[model samples]
Target: MSRSVSSHTSPVVRVDDLRVVFPTMDGDVHAVNGLSFEVPAGGALGIVGESGSGKSVTSLALMGLHRGSRARISGAIEVAGQNV
Candidate 1:
């Protein structure tokens, strides 16, 4: 589960300042804010949070599977060393 930072060929995924916002009847829900992390090639990473913590949304974002097109996402998201 551990990997040498310099040994990995490239980051399997890279998220920087990643944010996701949703507009609702009340206003806006900040699902994610300034989230940042990297999973290097052949490496393991874990995300832990309470319900509605944006955990699934963040992973889906990495897979390019966010539900709404209206969702506002800022910052950078890279997968397999490529921007998405």
Candidate 2:
């Protein structure tokens, strides 16, 4: 069953001013830059961009799959009102 989103309920996922930079021998590669959005309860998300436009990188950042790597992550990422 589908339910309407509650105005009073907090977002299920929130990403604010997120940035992901991968340091390389040559130079730094910006995977995701200044990306911010929120998906409320019972809400949905869609990311559309060209190839190499940080789509996959953003998803990885949300899941914290970039950890243990040389990637530098900043800003605030929250899921269910808890930091990710």
Candidate 3:
């Protein structure tokens, strides 16, 4: 996919290299692996993925909804033009 500059100002949410990892009994399971996307204000976005594709996890991360302290996250997550 091509990353194009939005015609407007900064997007409402800008996710770059967003990674979400969960710790399992076996080892650390990588949910979101270096996934990057941008959602401009008033723009609609859809994420298509099978089970365990990190679709829900990515949204949870963006909405600050994650369980346990064992979840390890890296990279950048910006919401409302502010990095979280």
Candidate achieving the largest lDDT: 2
How many collisions per candidate? 0, 0, 0
Task: Please report, as a residue range, the 10-residue window in candidate 2 with the lowest summed lDDT.
Answer: 1-10
Model 1 residue 68 CA deviation (Å) reads 4.5
TM-score of each: 0.82, 0.92, 0.83
lDDT of each: 0.84, 0.94, 0.84
RMSD of each: 2.6, 1.5, 4.7
Top TM-score hit:
2
Better of 2 and 3 by lDDT: 2
Q: Best to worst by lDDT, what's the order?
A: 2, 3, 1
What is residue 37's positional error in candidate 2, in angstroms? 0.4
State the local distance difference test value for candidate 1. Answer: 0.84
lDDT-wise, the better of 1 and 3 is 3
Question: TM-score of the candidate numbered 1?
Answer: 0.82
Off by over 4 Å in 2: 1-3
Q: Tell me the spans in candidate 3 whose CA falls farther than 4 Å from its real position.
A: 1-6
